[model samples]
Target: MSARLATGALVNALVRRAGSAGGFATVLAKGDATAGAVLIVAQDRGENPRLLERGIGPTGDVELIAVGPDGDAQAIADYWSRRRRNDPDLWVVELDIAQAERFAAETMLGD
Candidate 1:
């Protein structure tokens, strides 16, 4: 299995990458330093909010699971808030970028 990144390192890297690309990112809630699950909120061009999580595809490649749009921002936030309650070790990383899918395709790592 591929090595997983520490939560802090992962957050730092993501923030740096996003800034360099002219997009902005920030952590909504911090989680365990060593083994937190990353739940990304990909916001594209001020519309179409999506919930993203990393997972392995059938082909063994790293895949970003996009949980389609959950209508408005408030609705998605509420959805995630409920989820966060269940998994306290979840990291909420929001990305405001032009193309969220491209960001996922570029960053997610897999074996």
Candidate 2:
């Protein structure tokens, strides 16, 4: 499947997972080359610092996940690992919900 389709599927799955826990997840693809913060939320001082050390900064209602040719599943795993440490109470996944929705639609249509 195309990367976009795969990403969409991943997102859709994550959204469902988030929904089960009363949280929400969304996907935002950058049409331009502009890079900026994706999420900004308060974290305790004892929280996991890997994200900060990796330049992730913080987590907000929206968190940024990298998607592209250079992006791989390992990147997603690393992101989640850091996120879990930073917020043990929250659940984070690497799938892209928007992409996942599209994937689901296509799959339903048997495309």
Candidate 3:
């Protein structure tokens, strides 16, 4: 069987990695420790903010899929707000990285 990492560890790893890379990272919403889903919002200085959610592909591999090119703050906030209402255990992380998808690809747990 494959081992999975906990949510809290992933959150901390993300924060530390972003900081070490000279970027900013913060957890907007805390979630369940064991099985919460992670959503990442990547924003750059004058570009559209992109949102990615953790997903499992057909082959059982984890990947980041773009939710939207949401440069609008209110729109992204509103979207997550609606999502938060449904899943109180969902984690939302904001990372100020240009290539934010790499974070998910590198951080996601695997065999």
Candidate 4:
């Protein structure tokens, strides 16, 4: 599958995982013909955040990642690194659907 498709699939998996956390997951997707796309997930304090990582905000935290038909892994990493450097706490996760599935399964194990 194409990178865009892969990314989209990963984002969908994340949304699903988030939703399973008792309505504590929120996703924001935006795109333009030229600008490409991005997926953002806000996960509130719940088993989900604890599953992913503890110490996240109770109100939730933002997970931003680029999506769609442009940019390679390095580009995506650099883009976020350059712009989001001010927010040093940002976590960068690169995954496909299979990886996401494994992540979900592992997280469900409660570390």
Candidate 5:
């Protein structure tokens, strides 16, 4: 199996990449550095928000899966709050930018 990057490192890289691309990225909740799962809350300048997480796609390759509420901040917050309660080791990140989904997919799958 191919090696995976540490969760902390991946988060750092993603934050930097997003900032460099004129976007805003921040870690909402930090998780285990080595093996935690990551959840991305992506938006276009704070609009059209989507919550994404890496999961096995139909072809068995890793892909970003939409797993939470979109377009409503309160709903998204509630969803993630419930998720964090269940999985304390899940990392939550929010990225606001144009094409936020693309940025998230690239940062996550590229590794």
Candidate 6:
């Protein structure tokens, strides 16, 4: 099996990439640095909010899965808050960009 990137490193890289691309990215909650799971809150300039997480698809390949509410910012925030409460090891990052979902998926699954 291939090795995985540390959660902290990935988070930093993602933030840098988003900023470099003229977008906004920030960590909502910090989790374990070594092996925490990441949850991405993607939005297009603070609109069309979506929650993305890496998960195994039916074909067994890891892919970005859309979880929680869509379009509504408040519902998405509540959803992530609830999830974070349950999984304290989850890293929550918010990305507001042109193609937030694509950026999140590439940065998260590329490594």
Best by TM-score: 5
Query: Would you list the C-alpha lDDT of every candidate in the order shown?
Result: 0.78, 0.34, 0.80, 0.36, 0.91, 0.91
Model 1 residue 19 distance off true place after TM-score fit, in angstroms: 0.8
Candidate 1 Cα outliers beyond 4 Å, as residue runs: none
Model 4 Cα lDDT, one tens digit per residue, 17-95: 6456443333322223222333232223321211132232445643322232233444444554553455433333333
TM-score for all models, in order of appearance = 0.86, 0.27, 0.87, 0.28, 0.96, 0.95
Q: 1-111 in candidate 2: lDDT tens per residue?
A: 432324335445545765564444443231112222222121123232111111232453222333222234455456655654664433332223333333323322232
Among all windows of 10 consecutive residues in model 3, the one with the lowest summed lDDT is 102-111
Question: Which of the two, 4 or 5, has more TM-score?
Answer: 5
Per-residue lDDT of candidate 5, residues 43-107 (tens digit): 99788888999889889999999997888998998999898999999999999988888888888
lDDT of 5 at 86: 93
- Once fitted onto the true fold, the runs of candidate 4 whose alpha carbons sit more than 4 angstroms away are 1-5, 32-111
Per-residue alpha-carbon lDDT of model 6 for 1-111, expressed as tens digits?
999989999999999999999999999999999999899999997888889988898899999898889988899889989998999999999999998878888888985
TM-score, candidate 4, is 0.28
Clashes of 4: 0
- CA-only RMSD, every prediction: 2.0, 14.5, 1.9, 13.9, 0.9, 0.9
lDDT of each residue in 1-111, candidate 1, tens digit only: 567778778777887888999998889887777878778888876677888887777788768777635547987788778878998988888888988767755775522
Screening candidate 2 with a backbone cut-off below 3 angstroms (N, C-alpha, C), the clashing residue pairs are: 8-99, 8-100, 9-100, 11-96, 11-97, 40-60, 41-59
- Worst 10-residue lDDT window for candidate 5 reads 102-111
